[model samples]
Structures are given as C-alpha cells and as structure tokens.
Target: MRRRKLHNLQEEFINKFLETIENNEEYLEFINRHKPELLSNCDIAIREVKFFDVFNNTQLNNLIKGISNLNKEKYSIDLSLMSKKYKDLNYLIIQYDNSSTRSLCEVTFKDDLFINNVRAGFTQINNNQAVVEFSISFKEIMTHNLWIDFIKENKELLYGKKFFGYYNIGEMIKSAHFALIYNSISKVIDAALQAKLLSVFSLNFGNEYTLPQYNAIHVPQEHFKKEYFDNMFLCRTYEINNKYLIVDITSDEGLKMDLYFSGLYSSINFLQLLARYRMDLYYFLFEKIERFEINRRVNKYFLNSRKRIALKDYRWLINKIRSLNDNKLRENYTDSRELLEDWKSFYDGKEEEFIDFENGQYTKKYNTIYSECFDHIKMAYSIQKENLVIYIATLSLIASLIGIVTTVLLG
Candidate 1:
C-alpha cells in the first residue's frame, strides 16, 4: 500500500511538470536541453506502477534517482529584479513559492539615478493559494494631486501603446492585489467594469501603463451592500456617475476604506495602500493588547468559546463589562486549577480516541463566530480610546480652574 502511494505521488508530480513545460515555452526549452531522459522515465513508470503493492525497493530507488537528475535549477522561485520602467514609477516583485517556508524581503529605490533608499521588511503568509504580503510602503508614492499632474504630463506613455512591454506595471499591480483575495477578485473586477470607473495614473510614468496590458480595476464599494449579519467587511465595489469603481473596503472592524484613503495615496497605489492600512491597524491593536497584558486572557476566552462567539455576544460582553466596571462581579475570578486538571486528563495520550472528524468541522464553524466577535471587540476598543482621551482632557481643564481659584483667594 505504501509503495503504491509513493508511486502515485510521483505520477502527480510528473503530470504537473509535463503540463508546466507544455504550457511554458521557456521551461520546455530548458527541460529539453537538460533532461530528456527524466521525462521519458516518468511516462514509463506510470504504466508499470498501477497496483497498490507493485513497486519494489529498486523501482522506488530508480524513481527518486530520475527526479533528482532533472534540471530543477531553472525553476527557482526568487525575486530576481526590481527596476523602474518609467522615470517616476518604480516596480517591485518577487518570484514566490507557496509550497514551503514564508519569504520576506525589503524593497528600496529612488528618483534621479538611485538616490537615498529606504528599506522595510515584508512578510507574506498564504492568504489562500497566492503567496502575498503587504509590507511595501505605498505612502512613498506622492499624493493624489501630484499623481494627477504626472498622468496629464504622460498620459500617452502610461496609458498609451508603449506600456505593453515585459513586466508591465498594470499587470503586476493586478496580480499582487488579486493574490490577496483571488477567489473574490473576479467578482470585484466585474462590478468595477459595470460601474465604469477604470483609469490609470502615475507621478513617475512615461506612458508605461499604455505600453502594458491593464487588468480590470476594482473598488470594493462598487459591489458589496452592507449586510446586517456580516460583522466583518468583505470585498465590494461601487458605481460613480454610471461607472463602476472600488470605493470602500472592510477587512476587520477597525479597518475601513476611509482610514486607508486618509493615508498618502488614496487611489493610485491601491493594493499596497490597503496593506499598509491593515498593517497600521493590526500593529496598533497588537501594541494595545500587549501593553494591557490581555493576550493570555483573551486567547483563553476564544479557545473556551470554541472560536464561535457571535457578533451580538461580543457586543453584549463589552457592554455588560462597561456597566460593571466598579462592581465586585467585574473583579470576580474563577480558579483555573480545576479546569487545568480536567484538561490534563485529556492530554494524556488519549486525544485521538476522543477527537473525531466531527470535531474539526465543529471547530471551523465556531472559528468564524469567534473571528466576528473579535471584530466587534476591536471596534469597542476604538471607542474606549476616544473616551479615554476626552476624559483626560476634561480632568486637566478642571484641575487648571481649581488652581486659578486658589491663587485668586490667596491674593
């Protein structure tokens, strides 16, 4: 049985390689020149290894040997280049591998033949299928006003015929953004086109967009209607003057399109801008949680709830706690010793006996619920911070009045 499994795995790998080479001319040429025998061996092996126990030790050894000899050097996934095609526009991309460890990099460049460069680390986790990261600083792009001027100055170059060259900026941006939410990206594109809000702009382009193919642009508000049940924001699109465009996006509660628009590039740098906006919010909340030393308790709360607390439940908890701030009930704590003992009983090498497939499905359902609950909590935090600031300012003003009164009485 094990022999068959290994052979089947090898067959799948071979099929993938064949398909890749057949579809990609560059790869096909590389394979033909370096390893013709490897391809033939794969085809023959598939015919011989059909049954569960067919492959003996020698056959398995030969299969491994043939694969190792293939010209795999040409298929390396790495970010090999970052160069500006336009005078003002700079491009950044890395060849990515989703099958392995996460890859992160820092991008830096400047105008006027490479001046002082800045560096920031970018780490991309798998959103689903595409390996994507949002560490690039879109704030580096000039404001919307300057971008307009740049577009006017080089409309023909950015949107003209010359922009269709290799490594096109338009395609890259689309690829990058689509990587973030590829499953829903097509819906966003369709909605944007229906709204008729497609346009390209750049402050540093010499008609680069015109030279390359442009992917359909999308804005979230153009499509998604605010649903009462969706406690988190999904990708959406909006229409302006009969043209479909992306207007707003919601990820978590603290993240909104308005917050992103407030940053430097409200429109031109869409993907990177959204990423920067999310990072700011994520880090902001992370710092607050760490500073308050609430990670352990919050995490425990999530686990106990089976990660399925509803949005309404989240609001209720926050409001109830807010009302009970000074009450002894707020300070009352449950001793965890008994709970720990119970957990330990399950931990003693008997987890497999108790946990069935149904538990996995149940966990997923609850996880969504728990995520929505956290979104509401984040919104509550934002409100709490605003109130805190107002309270401090009011207290300061009152103290100043008391000091002024005391001085006058003494005089």
Candidate 2:
C-alpha cells in the first residue's frame, strides 16, 4: 500500500512539474539548453514475454532470486533436493528481454500441493551474446513499477534479447530434451499466457466504454449492496490513495476499474510526452494571454477594433482559459463578476499587484489559471465596451466567455 501511494505521488509530481515548466519562460529556456531532445521521439513500441513452460532445475530457488535481484532487492536462496529430510517447496522464475518486460514462472513440486501444472513454448532471442540472469527472493513481486525503474536506471549495460524458461530437472533425464530446447519451450508458453492477459485487458477498454467520474455522482452505499455498481464505486473510494483521488476515474467502478486506471496512467504518460515536446505551445499560450490582456488596456486599436479572430486562435484561448478552472481557483471564481472586477484593476496600470499571477509564481499558483482567465475576459469586455454593436467582434468576445462557461458547466 505504501509503495502504491508513493507511485501515485510520483505520478502527481510529474504532472505538476510538466504543468509548471510549460507555463514558465525562464524554466523553458533552461530545458531547451539542458534536455531539448526529450520528447523528440514518441513512437514507442511495447512488447512482452507471452508464454513459458515448467521444467525441473536443481537451482530453481537461486533462479527466482536472480529475477528479483534485477529489481534492486537482495534475495537469499534456499534449495532442496528431494532427499529424506525435506519435501516442501514454493519457487518462481521470471524471464525478461532487453526492454526489461517480464514473464513469471511458478514451480511447486511438493507432493501435498493442490495445484500442479506446467506449460512451455519457444521464442527467438534477438541478441545472441546476451547473458541470461534471474532474481530469486522472498520479496513480493507486487512492486513492478520499482522493478522497471531498477532496469531503466541501468539500461545501457543491460541491453540484450532474452525470454523465459522453467526446466524440470526430475523429468529432463527421462524426457531427453536439450537445455536450449527447455528454455525455448518454456518462454513460448509464458508468451502465450502474457498475450492472453493483454488481449483480454485491451478489449475491455476499447472505444465504446466511457468511464464514470466519481466526483459527478453520489452513490448511496448504505442502502445498496456490493453487487450494485453504485455502491461498489462508493466503497472503492476507500481503496484509492489521496494523490489519485481528484483525477482517478476508476474510483467510480465502471465496467473495468483496473483496466481504466491502467489506461489512464498510460494516457497521462503520453500527455507528459506531449508536454515535453510542445513545451513551446504552453509558453506561447501563457504569454499570449498576458500580452492580450495588457494590449487591450494600453492600445487604442485593440479597444475600438471589432475584428474576429480565427477559430483556431479562439480554441487555443479557450483551452488556456479552461486550464485556470482547476481546484485551486474554485473559491476565487465563486463570484465571476467580482473576479472580473479584480482583473480589470490589475490590467489598468496595476500590473505590479498582479505580477505574481502573470508570472505563474504566486503561492496560490494553482489559482493562476483562474486569475488568467478572469483577466482575459475582463480585457475583452474593456475592448468591446465602446463598439459593442460590431457583430463579429462582439461574437468573438462572447465566444471567449462561452468557452469558460462551457468548461465550468460541462467539464
């Protein structure tokens, strides 16, 4: 649970960091100099081990520990040969490729065990010289996120094509199979299983389903049973970490909460990639908002002119305005008229009072969007005050107002 909480916190931190950098000029300049190529390549391909077989090995305990060690955790191996003294066993082996995508293998040879089944198949190794390694440990395999981090932090040295395998030492002598054949067969089975899981999960969230937002619905858990989705959704709220509370749509318990959350995480990751690449878009819009407000006040042409801007320009402006409607600005925007009044005061040569907001550096910085949107609408009102009769310009200004209203009402 703690690890999951930390994962959610890390995700939130990444999003806020993306937002902050995109909104700041000096910070962007720093990025262009230091890490400009970050989002240059976004066409990523994801593949995984899909199948494997259960084989007998004298060193199964050591092998599982080897898999666990790839994730930065130390493991002590315990091995037992079916001698007269001991007979209990629970062990696993994990095989992965150069990208560090993994497949799990479990072996339970105890006579008293309830479950016993083994499947295997073959897959080609892309790198001939790659060495096979494993992690054998007592630590739970639940923290897959941290394990990926361990591989990524050392990817340069770890690159190699590989797959998974489980060898049955007890059957090898009788079966007459080579070591390489055992490895190949096990990986094939593992790959098939992995593929099945991915297929089922992917289809569950395809285009037709729209996950519900918990914040929009009130589920009465007291009268409804767990079998009812509404009650389940409300009960599931307790399972969500605070860091994921505001943004996680899965808390509402739609058709498939697990897949919804997984897709949501992937979507956020893709957005971060966009944030890294189109950082200039953010800066451009932020500056545009400021300059537009300041120009409306200082330039007479902007105040009297009734020119309609392009639809694209209006859309960009609308998105920027909506961004300011987050939780941080909810209270500030309670009275829209008052909000606009304060913004007008800031624009009419009171720039110093609003410097903190203009720069997106105020303590109430989360309210930066609210402040920016308010200032923008107020500026538009001031611009059209004299010539409200010009239909195009009047409509343009009204369109901007409608953008904010639509975002608040529907978003």
Q: Where does candidate 2 stray beyond 4 Å?
A: 1-315, 328-363, 385-411
**What lDDT would each prediction earn against the true structure?**
0.28, 0.28
Candidate 1 per-residue lDDT over residues 1-411, each given as its tens digit:
354554454344333322333454544454466464333222211000000001122322332233233233422112322323222211222222211222222233233121122111222211211112222222323332332333333323212122122222234333443222222322222222111111211111112111101122222332323321122234233322232222223222111121111112222222232122222212222222222223333544445543343455456445433222212221211231221222111121122232111112322333344456567566655666788799999999999999999999999
- Residue-level error in angstroms, candidate 1, position 308: 44
When summed lDDT is taken over every stretch of 10 residues in candidate 2, the lowest stretch is 122-131
The TM-score obtained by model 1 is: 0.19
TM-score of each: 0.19, 0.16
The TM-score that candidate 2 achieves is: 0.16
lDDT of 2 by residue, 1-411 (tens): 354554454344333333333454544454456452322111111211111111223233333343333222221213222222233233322222111222333332233111122211111111111112111121222122332332233222211111111233324333533333322322232222333222212211111112111111112223222222222232222112111112222221221112112111211121221122122212221333334333543243234454533344445445444433322222232232332232211121122233122323432442454356446555665565555567777899899999999999997
